[model samples]
Target chain A: MSVLEISELTKSYPVPGGGEPRRVTVVDVPRFVVSAGEQVALEGPSGSGKTTLLHLIAGIVAPTSGRIVVAGHDMTALGEAARDKVRARHIGYVFQTFNLLQGCTALENVAMGMAFGTGVEAGRARELLERVGLADRADFLPRQLSSGQQQRVAVARALANRPALVLADEPTGNLDRRRAREALALMREVCAESGAALLLVSHDHDILSQFGRVETMAAINRAFATADGNSPVETR
Target chain B: MSRVPHHPVALLVRRSLRQHALSSAVTMAAVALAVGLVMSVFSIKDQARNAFTGGTMGFDAVLGARGSPLQLVLNAVFHLETSPGNIPWSLYEEIRRDPRVALAVPFALGDNYHGFRLVGTTEKLFADFEYRKGRRFEVEPGGRMFDPTRREAVVGSYAARRTGLRVGSTFQPFHGLFFDPDTQHEEEFTVVGVLKPTNSPSDRVIWIPIEGVYRMEGHVLRGSGEVYTPSPHEEIPDEHKEVSAVMLKLRSPAAGMALNQTVNRQGTVATLAWPIAQVMADLFERIGWAHRILTLVAYLVVAVAAGTILASITNTINERRREFAILRALGARRRTVFGTIVAEAAALAGLGSLAGYVVYLAIVATAAVIVRAQTGVVLDVLAWHPVLVAAPAGMTLLGALAGVLPAFKAYATDVASNLAPAS
Candidate 1:
């Protein structure tokens, strides 16, 4: 069974001008799927709509037209509040900037992921921090940590609720080469151990090659394919 | 760990405030100042009204020569104003013998010791003059009520302390209601007593015998501005004597109406006043506009404080756009973000109002002694007024209203746009 499935997804933003409004198509994907426990990397240059596709799958952004099913829930048919509930119950997001709340500690940042659910799972957060090699740094605030350590904390927070799918958008974007490779390995190892599917976006070919299955935004996004004359790939 | 889990909104607000510690402190201080001003205004107004009304509760009616009834009560009871005119001393005898009269204490004004008023009356003032309900004047230790026949005096506690006059001290009276050393009466009186503190306007007066005033060199009934100096052997006539005003206590509260009507009908002889009613009406009539203006100013200050909170939060929300987006990406609903901002505002107002109330009490505690000494009104620092509750509640509502614009901004934050690498 697929943990995340998308078909005919489209997103366009209205650009206001002196005359009538014009539509700019940002994302146009025909079909995409991530099987349970599979690790897939989506590589795209800037403005290729990789982040927009990730946001659409995570239910963080509404698609213009599509059917998106994440962990058995049809996200496209649900209202915003219900989509938020579905995201909280089944999806985890790790941003490129390691956007930890400034004054909160590592443990608190992790616990905050579960705060919107029924109750905060502090024990689970602590266990996840330990799994991410941040057990000794749980009480350290984001400013106190180095970039690599902050990224590790963000990874721990993303897995705090043990969701079925984890989304990582250039999680190593701020780290040195060695630290980026190490952070990638840590995220993949943690996700595998927790039996969660991983969908990561990166523009680096070296990191893209590390995943078992790699898909290019030019091969998945119809908007990029049409603009660049790159042919779309068939879904596996 | 047994720590209770806080809501996400609460935690976020806590973190946000902690991140912006200086702004939060400044906002809270502004709120505290506004709340303190409002609370002090309400409290002082209540205490002042209480002191003024309570001070006159002992006497039901005041009888003096035809004049403003409020002025008659102010001069006779509170010693706050000069007497309008004097009624003949024979009227005191008639009022004393009236069936409806319970107690009739005569007062003779127009004399001063230093700045304190010098009242001339019989010992009936000490024995029967009720300062508060069921409370009468008592002489302090090592002192006794002065004899009316000799040149003796009884000074109120405040007056004794202020004038440095003890039981054996001698002081001459000034010729008028205000002290003038050049116009001092030649006859001096010995302070035979110091009255205990009564927390009334009477606390600032010196009591002398009515004969002492009449026998003075310049107080004879020769009309206005006349200075009469009789020879040592000359006799002072009884018909020429006068008393400033008479404080009356009716035998039955119902007799007040009839007695007031009777006195007013005396046709230029005298006018009667119900002390409490007349003083209250006069007080509201005279200072009412100022009070309302002050109250409006205080509320405007509170509104400005709310506006300050609104501006502070809205200004910071621009920088917090990404943080709010992060929360939404972590599955927090827009309402959650909205409520977090609103909660932040309410928390500021709540804490600020509480701090302001503490500040107000501190001020009142520090001012209590000075107020009592100056106005004979003791402020109860811990006394609860409705404004104590209403002020904070209003501030909280104002804070919520202040939060609306910022909360809406937070609610409309674009999660995907903020989280994108382009951002």
Candidate 2:
């Protein structure tokens, strides 16, 4: 069964104009799917609607028209509140900036992931932090931790709920080469251990070869094709 | 995350406040100052009322020369002001013999010992007068009431302490209610006794025999201000005797209205004043306006403090837009984000009010002694009034209301745009 499935998905925004407003589509994907526990990487250059696609899949943003099924829930048919509940119960997200609550300790940040849906389990959050090799840094606030350590904490928080799928957007964007490699390896290990499918978005070419399956946004996002004709759609 | 099930919004609020420590402190201080001002007003008003009502408990009516009822009560009961005029000694005797009068204690004013008023009265005042219900005056240990024949005095404990007069101390009396060194009487009175503290205006008085005041040089009758000098063999005339006011206790509380009407109907020779009613009415009439104005100002301060909370939280929400967006992405509903912001504002208000109450208590505790010394009003900081509870509750509600704008802004935040790489 597919953990995430999208068909005919698109997102658009209206640009204010002196005359009539014009709508610009940002994400246009005909079909996309990730099998249960599958590790897929979506690579795209800047302004290719990569982040918009991730947001649409995670149910954070509603699509203009499409079917989006995450962990068997039809996100497209659900309201914003229900979609949030679905995300909390079955989907986890890791942002490019780590996005840890500034004053929250690492363990607390992880615990907060489960705060809305199932109620926070401190033991589970601590265990996840330990699994991410941050057992000694559980009490350290986001600002106190190094970039690599903060990313590790974010990964731990994403996996805190043991969701069916984890979406990471440029997880190692702020890290050094070695730290980025370490963060990527830690994310992969945790996702595999939790039996959650991984959908990672990044523009970094050096990290592409490490994933088993890689999909480029240009291949799927129809909105990117007409805007940048020199770029060719390709997937490997 | 330590095995405790904590609300995420609560954690977020705490974290947010900690992140902006200086702003939070300033907001809390503003709230504290407003609460303190409000609570102090409430406490002072309550204490003053208690002192006024409690001080007049011994007397039901004041009979004095035609004058303001309020001034009569103030002079006769609280010793707060000078008597307007003198009533004839025969009127005191008439009230004492009246069927409706339970007790009539004559007060002869126009004399001061040091700065304390020298109240000229009989020992019946000590034996019959009740300061509070069933609470009578008691002489301090090893002290006794003064003898009426000799120039002896019984001082209240407060007066003794304030004037540094002991049982063997002798002091010359000043000729008027206010002390004047040039008008000092040559006759000296010995302090033969000291009364225990009564927690009333009585505690600030020096009690001397009424006959002793009549015998003093320069003493005059009700209509005469002539200085009466007794020759070596001449007896003082009884018709020349006078008293400042007569404090009357009624046989029944219901008889007070009848006796008061009777005394006032007997022409302008003497007027009846109900001590409690007159003092309270005077107090509410005079101090009531100031209380209302102060209360309005205090409420305004609280409202402004709430506005401060609103401004502070709204400012924070604007800066924390991205942080909230990240939480929304983490599966928090918009209401959750909204609630977190509201909770932050409420927390600031709740903690600020709590701190404000503590500050109020500290101020009341520190001022209690001085307030009692000056106004004879005991300020009990532990006294529980409904306003104490209402003030904080109102402040917290105002704070939550203040959070409404900021919370709505947080709820309507654009998660996608805020989380975008460009943003």
Best by TM-score: 2
Q: What is the lDDT of residue A47 in candidate 2?
A: 75
lDDT of candidate 2 over B1-423, digit per residue (tens):
244338888788888899999989999988887887788889877776766765445787888889788888888777777788887767787889989899999888888877688889987898888877888888877778999877999998888998999889999999888778888999899988898877777878899998888777787554334545545345556556678888888888678778766777756688888756655667777878899998999989998899899989988887899888888888899999988888888888889999988888987887787765654556678888777888788888888888889999999999888885621
| Model 2 TM-score on a 0 to 1 scale | 0.94
Isolated chain B TM-score per model: 0.89, 0.90
- Candidate 2 error regions (>4 Å): A19-21, A229-236, B1-5, B54-56, B179-187, B216-227, B230-235, B362-371
lDDT of 1 by residue, A38-81 (tens): 99999887777777788888888888998999999999999999
Candidate 1 lDDT, B1-423, residue by residue in tens: 323246777777787888888988888888988888788888877876776766544788888888888888777776776789988867888898999999998888888988788889998888987878789999899999999878999998888988999999998888888778888888889999999988777788899988777777776663233434445556656556678888888887678778777777645678888655555667766997888998899889898899889998999998989899888888899999999999999988888898998778877777777776655456788888898888888898898889989999999998876775641
Quality of model 1 by C-alpha lDDT? 0.83
C-alpha-based local distance difference test score of model 2: 0.83
Docking class of 2: medium
- Residues A7-81 of candidate 2 have per-residue lDDT tens digits of 999888776568887778877899999999999998888677777788888888888999999999999999999
